[model samples]
Structure formats: structure tokens, C-alpha cells
Target: MLLERGVTDAELQAEANRIAVKVESIFSSYLAGSGDGRDRLFEAMRHAGLGGGKRLRPLLTVATGRLFGIAEDRVIRAGAAIEAIHVYSLIHDDLPCMDDDDLRRGKPTVHRAFDESTAVLAGDCFHDLAFEIIADTATHEDPFVRAELVLEMARASGPNGMAGGQMLDLVAEGQVLDMGSITRLQQLKTGALIEFAVEAACIMGRLPPEARTPYRGFARDIGLAFQIADDLLDHAGDEAVAGKRLRKDAHAGKATFVSLLGEDRARQQCSILIGQAIEHLEHHGEEADLLRAVARYVEERDR
Candidate 1:
């Protein structure tokens, strides 16, 4: 299917990798100018921000923005904001009080690489920096679009979105949750940012909700598929390639799509979700080829 549109999976991967590099550079440059009295916090921020990850959210933002003919620089700036917020969440999530993770992106987590206090400050700084980037007029000439982007990002990452979901996850620890409950949990925990990634493109383009509604649906399906893939990877994926601890959910006795649906069923559900996600893009032209490949790649990716 990807080949028919002249968009190969490799090409899509290459595009995402390119975006990752761009975002890393943006972050590195942003932290490089830190003055005295806070160099360690900035260093921790650079470590967490520039360290390798899939940068999937930024890719989604950039790809969707490109579809609307937004300028590459503007979209890349927005992508950087998305990645900053994401890395910030990762830093906090790895804190001793949180997930207590020691490894991330094949290196020691921010807290492990630096002191816990510095890691906390790094996460806080990145969180603040995300909005600063989006709010800057340089991200968009129009003030309204920049404001909308900031507001959307706030909702996506604030109590109603990722943070709220994390709170719920903390409370639900070691407790059995039903499918509906778990779905809602994962939607908020992981899906909110993914939704923001796609919807931010609409804001970047100054497009109305009616125009970007399909992409929202696309984000919804892909978000769940992405979580399911994560669960599957955690269930059986190699920790070396995954670059973190695997089977933590199972060990913690947390219910996941893989645990609840079984590996085969969870895999089948991912296929179904990807199909639906692709369906939402039918109204788009070949320009949306990258999104289609992204959907397929999420299903097939090993890390």
C-alpha cells in the first residue's frame, strides 16, 4: 500500500529520523547558552532532551503541518515544543517518586545521570520552555495561532490530559481495572500528547476544527494503537532494543491491553486500529502518504 503512493516504510522512517535530529539540535542549542549557577540543570535538560528517542510526536506534528502547506521552520519549531514537553514528562516519570526508572534511550535517566534535584529542575524547565517556544511569534506570524497552540498544549499536558492520566495511573497501581477504565487511562496517559501532535498542526495552519476533525480521529485510533504496541513491546520486546526495562507492567501487576487481550488479540486490535486510522485520511491526497506510512509503521515497529 505504501509503495503504490511511492512512500516506502523506509522513507517514512527516514523522515521521522530527520525530524528527530532537527528536534535534538533545537534542544541542544536552546540549552547550550545556560549561564553560571544553573549549568548542571541545563546539562541535565540537554541530556534528557537530546538523547535519542523515536521522536514520533514531533514527526506527527511536522507531517500534519506539511500537509497544510505550513512553513517548515514554523512547523519544526512547533515540533520542538512538542518534543520538549515529551522529554519533560519522561524526566519526571523516571523520578524516584514516580516510575523510578534508571534507564532511558539507552542511557541513564536524567535523575540517575544527575542529582534528583537537577532532574526535577530540568523537567520543570523543559515544561516551561515548551510553552515559551509555542508562544513565541517566531513560531507563527499570527498571534491567534500561537495562542491557540499554547492553549491546546496546556490542555493536552495539564490535569485534564497527560498529568491527570498519570495521577490516575498512580492510584490504580496494583488494582485491576476494566477495559473501559484502562482505555480511558491510556488515552489520557499517552494518547493526549499524540492528539496534541496532530491537532497542533491544525492550529499551526490556522485551520478550523471541521477541517482537522478527521486527523483527530486519526490521532485517536493511532494513539490507542501506539499504546497497544507499547504494551506488546513491554510484554516480550528485548530490553536492549527497547532501551528500558521491559515487562514492568506485568511485574507490577498492572493491567495492559496485552495482558487483558493476550498477545495475539492485542496484535489483531492494533491492525484494526491502524486500518481505521488510515480510513480517516481517505479525504486527503498523496501528500498524506507519510501519515499512512506512520500508521503502518506503528504497527510494525520493534522499538
Candidate 2:
């Protein structure tokens, strides 16, 4: 597969390292450049970005941008922004008030690493940086377009999207939910940002309206697919391999794909979603291959 050939462990790690370094450098005003007020911004931003993960969201943004023949530098900037959004989500999710997670990517959660206040503030600052980068492109003729894309991202990440789903999760906690409600919860909580990611690239690249609709559909499917695969991983994968705590879903009594469908059927659903995700890519062929590979990678990866 085109995506399979492109994705490699070394490729991911190298990409993560470079993006982490670049994000810090690009946003260093908080740390290296300015007023005391900015110092806290840099600290929180760095705490999350440099904290470490696979950098999948950033890579997804970049890979999709490449579909339109966008320049590498622009792609890198956009990629870094995506990473910021993702880590920011993680920072908030790991809070004692949220997921209450102590470990993230095998390290202390942001709140644990610094303090609860710092973690909350860090997530907020990262959110600010994401818009800053996207909006800063106003010098370009397409600045309005880029700004719109960022707006879409903000909607997905904010109370209406990720946060909304999280609220539902909290309310539904420890309760038995029907499959439909469970899927809806996952779509909002886990899938919103991912859907925004693919569409963001499409919008930025200025894909034709005809093509953009398909990309939106593709994004929605892959978003749900990846989330289900994550649920599958929670059960079948180990903490050592999953890169964080394992079986936390069952421990927390959250309804997951595995919880509703059982491991075998959940794996079966993963295959179906992966297949559908790839099928969605067929319209764009190689242009969509990287995303196709990403869907496959998400399905196959233990972590």
C-alpha cells in the first residue's frame, strides 16, 4: 500500500522529534524571547509538546496537505499546529477533573509533571498557539481560508465538540449505554478533532468543493475507525506496548467497542472501518494513500 510504504517506525519518531523541536522554536517567545508573562506560556507549551508522543495528528495534517502540492514549510507549520491541538487535548484530558490519568505516553501526565494549574493553563496556551499559527498566515492571499479552517478546528476542540463529548461521558459514567449512544459519544469525544484534521488540510489546500465533501465524509469515517481501534487496543494491548496505561476503559467502566462488541467482533469492526476508510481514499488515489495508510496503521498498531 502507498501509505504502508510511507509509514515506518523510524519515519514517525524522526517526524516527532523534528516537529517537537520546531514547535518549541517557532513558539519560543514564551520561553526564549520575551516578557515574564510569556514565560509561563512557553513552559506550559513546552511541557506538552516536548513531553513526547507519536505525533500522529501533526503528521496527518502534513500528509493531507501534501496532497495539494503545498510547500514543505507551510506543511510543517500546519503540522505543528495540529500537534499543539492534540497535546493540548491530552493535557486537559489527563487532569484530575477529566480522565484523572497519572501516566501519558508512559510519563507523568501534564498535571503531575508540573501542577494542576500549570496543566490547565498549558492546554489553554497550546490552544492559543494553534490559532496564532493558523491566523498568522494572514500575509498570504489565502489567509482568510486558513483562518476559517482554524475556526473549524476550534469548534471541534471546544465545548461543542471534544468538550461536549467529554461532558456526556462524565454524565454517562458507570451507566450502561446503548450502542448508538456509545458510538455518538466516541464520535464527539474521540472523533471530532480527527475529522477536523482531514477537512482542515483539504480546506487549506483549496480542494474543489466536489472533492471537499468526500474528504469530509472520509474524515468522519476514519475518525470513528481510529477511535474504535483505540478501544480494541485497550483490551488486547498491554501497557508496555500501548505506551500508556492499559485496560483503563474497563477499569473506568466506559463503554468501548470492545465492551459492546467483545474483542473478536471489535476487531472485526476495525477491519470493516479500515476497509471503509481505504475505500473513501480510492477517489483521490495516491493523494489519499497516506491517510489510507494512517487508517491501516491505526488499526494494526498496539498503541
Candidate 3:
């Protein structure tokens, strides 16, 4: 019933894109006034963090916050913080030591466009900046809320989460990973931050922990589905549209859901997960329509 609401995918995308632009401006201004003319570092940071990608994580933050009627500006600030970490991860993920990617979001990888050292520094800067942004008083009126946001983000990005998953991924290369291991790897590498994106809204809204369970479910399922879709894209997706290289996992002999389960089975599983993800939003009513649409879009996207 709520799906019948007039909100369109285009509208959601527009809002998300708008947030992306705004965050880029905010981050750029911060960098400009930060210190001496260390212009190259700032340029590298801007290159990686600005003007690209789908901005899905930030959109999730904004969408979830909307469900609680949180201030749009506050949500945008949180989204910006989340996105800084995300972009930082991407910069590192594309490094020669990591994925060795030469292209990302249809442009040269930071390492490829700049230098390896500069790329590393840029990622490190963005990582630190994410925490600084979230901890700032401007992000929330309540100091406790800001502190909690910082703690949660640290947990999401640190050893128990993204970093741990990346370690597992590095290990999996040239080794066989069971489905369980693969699932765990993806849950940490991809799902943890996504979980934070949605859950942070609850913190920002001052919602009880109980209120996050459904959204958490939604994030977990969709996060996996999103990765599965990504696997499919890598399996046969066009590099031009994806704005990155494809089939690298196979080349590296890495394990992915698509590799473990065939295309047909992966598609089926992704659809099933999307169904589960959408069900989690029923309690949110029409306010979550955009999130529901996003779950479907994740599976259907070409890139």
C-alpha cells in the first residue's frame, strides 16, 4: 500500500545526488582552509571523494533519517561523514597493494591518477576526517549522540568490520574461501558500513535500540544483495558503465557468490534477499518507500 506513494526513484536519486554535491562542497571548503598549500593532498582527496559514484550510502543515511523526521541538514551532515569513510575505503581498495584497480567510477583510480603514496595519504586523510566530521558539534546538538555516532563509525570501519573483511579478502586471493567465509567477508566489508548508514539515523533521531532491528535487517539483507549484484556486474558487467574493471575476481581466482553459486542461483538469491529486505520496511509505512525502491534497484542495476 505504501509503495503506491507518489515518490519516484528519480526523486530519490536526485536527492541523493544533491547530497553528494553538497558534501563535496563542504569537504572542499574544509580542506581549503585547513593549512599550508599542501595542494596535491587536497587535490587527491577531492579527486577520490567528490564528483562520482552512486552515493548509495549517503542516500541510505538520508532516507533512514527521513523516516524519523530528523532535520534534513543534520542527516546530510551524518551522510557526509559516512561518505567520507566510504570514499576513503575506495581509494585504498583501488591501491596497487589491494585490488590494483586502475579505474573507478569511470575514472582513473587515485593511485593511477596520482601516485601510490599520495593515494594512500588521501585515503588516510579521509578516514580521519570522517571521525572529525561526525564528532563535530554541528553534526548533532546532543554531545552523547555525537559521541555515539563516532563510536559506531569507528566500530564499522575498524578491525571488527571493514578492515577485518579486507584482510579476509586479501587472504582469500589465491586461496579457496567457503561460502560461509565469503558471507562473513562481505558482511564486514560491505554490510557493516551500510548497517551504520541506516542505524546512525536511529541514533540521530534518538530512537531506542529496539527500533533499529528492522532497519538492521533491511540493511543486512540489502547489503548482501548489493554485493551479489556487484558480483554479477563483475562477472559480465560493462566496464564503461560500471566505471571500473570487471572480471578481476575471476582473474585473481577469488571467491564470490556468483562464482560459488552460478549466475542463475545468484540472481535467485539476490531476489530472495531483496524480498526479505523490503519486508523489513513494512513497519515504516510510506516513509520508507524510497528504501524499498532502493532494494529493488540494487538487484536490477547494470553497474
Candidate 4:
């Protein structure tokens, strides 16, 4: 069962699950003490943010931070902030005007579970909360570090990043795109925040900008690999296990890595990317075992 460095696939899943639980708790605490007719908004936010996720971005944050001996709790808080942004994006992405998904994580999406307006508000609140958490001293003791986290996270989630990618995706619908265009879209839409997850750790660890090049490279590779795996999953993955409507990309006429590249070739490319990702960590020791395991998990994950 051992994958590498005494880490197993099951162990990676367990850790992801554990991070999910911890993130749920953090979300609960933050959403608590809400009053004054905001209960429904809070409820919708909880429905969107609380349960059922891989928490991969947070895991990357914690794993990379561990390389510098950062306290787990500190990194977990930062990771939770990143998770909030992720949840916010998902909530909006599932709206009627967006992907129009009804199911997510084995249940009705926020818009389906609640109402559209409530879902929009919930997503908005989660976006606000992400920066609030990162800005607070509780996430990091250094004011400079907190500011940097906020700036990087904002950039990752802003127009030049996820939002821009989403726009590109919407525009690409029904249009045939070359591999370069698809790669650019995925890099912005999916890869940016993923890269930020690792970058946040380096920032917290006080690693110089120059020293973060390898980690950045690792993040970029894994981010693309993760999206390719997702496209493959959409191509043929089971809906029941994915807990969401599958084949939406194909149905929407969106060009994905799988759509442009054959499934076999996409899988092969994913393996290559993952290999490159792990090689980026060659300078590190076993302290990076979790990251290596994460890269493998990204390649092998079914959902």
C-alpha cells in the first residue's frame, strides 16, 4: 500500500478528509454569531462551504508550509482561507447563468438547495470572509506576511486569474480551441489559485521570491495535471462517485484537454506533468513526501 516515503494512497485520502473536517469546523466558527435576518444567507453559505470536498488547495498549503517548520495550525488557518475562496468560486460557478449545475459534492448545489439570490449572497460572503481571515493577525503573526497573503489571494481570484479563466471558458463554448488556448484558459481558471496555495506557504515560510521558483513550477504542473485529470473524469467518470453531473464540458461544447487530446494521450500527458511536478521537489528531502503524494493523488484521483 505504500506509495512512497511511507505514505500510502489511503493515508493521503485520510489526510484530505481530515483537512475537510477541520475546514468545516473553521467555517462553522466563522459563520456562527450571525443574526439580524442573515440566517438564511449563513445557511446557504454553510451548505456551499461546509461539507464534502477534497480540500486539495488547503492540503498543498499545509504540506508546503511543513517544509519550513511552520506550525500546522497556522498553516491550516491560511489553508482554510484559501478553501473559502474555492468554495465561493464553486458556489458562483454552479449558478444558473454559469455552469447551471444542480448537483455538487453529492448534494444539491447552493443555488439549487437555497435560492439564486441567496446563493449569490452566500458566495459573496464567502469571498469577503477569505480576505478577512487572511488579513487577520490570527492567520499570521507578521503583518507583512498577512498583507502578502491577501495580495496573492486577491490576484489569484481576480480578473487576471480565476475570473478571467471563467470568462474564457464561457467564450470558448461551441468554439473549437487549440491546445494553447485551452491551456491558457485552464492555467488562469484553475491553475492560478492552485499555484497560490503553494505560494502562500512560501510566503508564510519567509522563503525569498527567488527561492520559490521550484515550488511555483511544481504548483503549475500539478495544477494543469489536476485539470487534465478532471477532464478525463468528466469524459468517463461515474456520476455517482463524482457526486456531480459529469460530461458537462462535452455537453456544453467546451474544449478541454480531453476534448482536444484523445483520452489516452491526455492521460499520458497528465503522467508526464505529474512526473515533472515531483521532479521540482528533488532538492527537498522526505519533508516533501506529502507533496509528492499529493501529485500522485492528483494523477490518480477519480473525482
Q: Best-fitting candidate, measured by lDDT?
A: 4
lDDT of 2 by residue, 23-123 (tens): 55655543452567766656666666774576667667766776787765666666667667777888898899888988888777878878898898889
lDDT of 4 by residue, 177-220 (tens): 99999999999999999999999999999999999999999999
Off by over 4 Å in 3: 1-6, 33-37
Q: List clashing residue pairs in candidate 1.
A: none
Model 4 ranges with Cα > 4 A deviation: 1-5
* lDDT against the true structure, each candidate: 0.88, 0.74, 0.86, 0.90
User: In model 3, which residue pairs have backbone atoms overlapping below 3 Å?
Assistant: 106-243
- Compute each candidate's TM-score over C-alphas: 0.97, 0.88, 0.95, 0.97
Report the C-alpha lDDT of model 3 over 1-303, residue by residue, as the tens digit.
344534676886687678788788768766773466678898888888878888788788888888899887888778888889999999999998888999998889999898999999999999988988888876545888898888999999999989888998988778898889999999999999989999898899898898788889999999999999999999979988999999999998898999899999999999999988888888777778777777777888887
The 10-residue segment with the lowest total lDDT in model 1: 1-10
Clashing pairs in 2: none
TM-score of candidate 3 against the unseen true structure: 0.95
CA shift of 202, model 3, Å: 1.0
- Give per-residue lDDT, candidate 4, residue 72: 79
> Where is model 2 more than 4 Å wrong at Cα?
1-41, 138-141
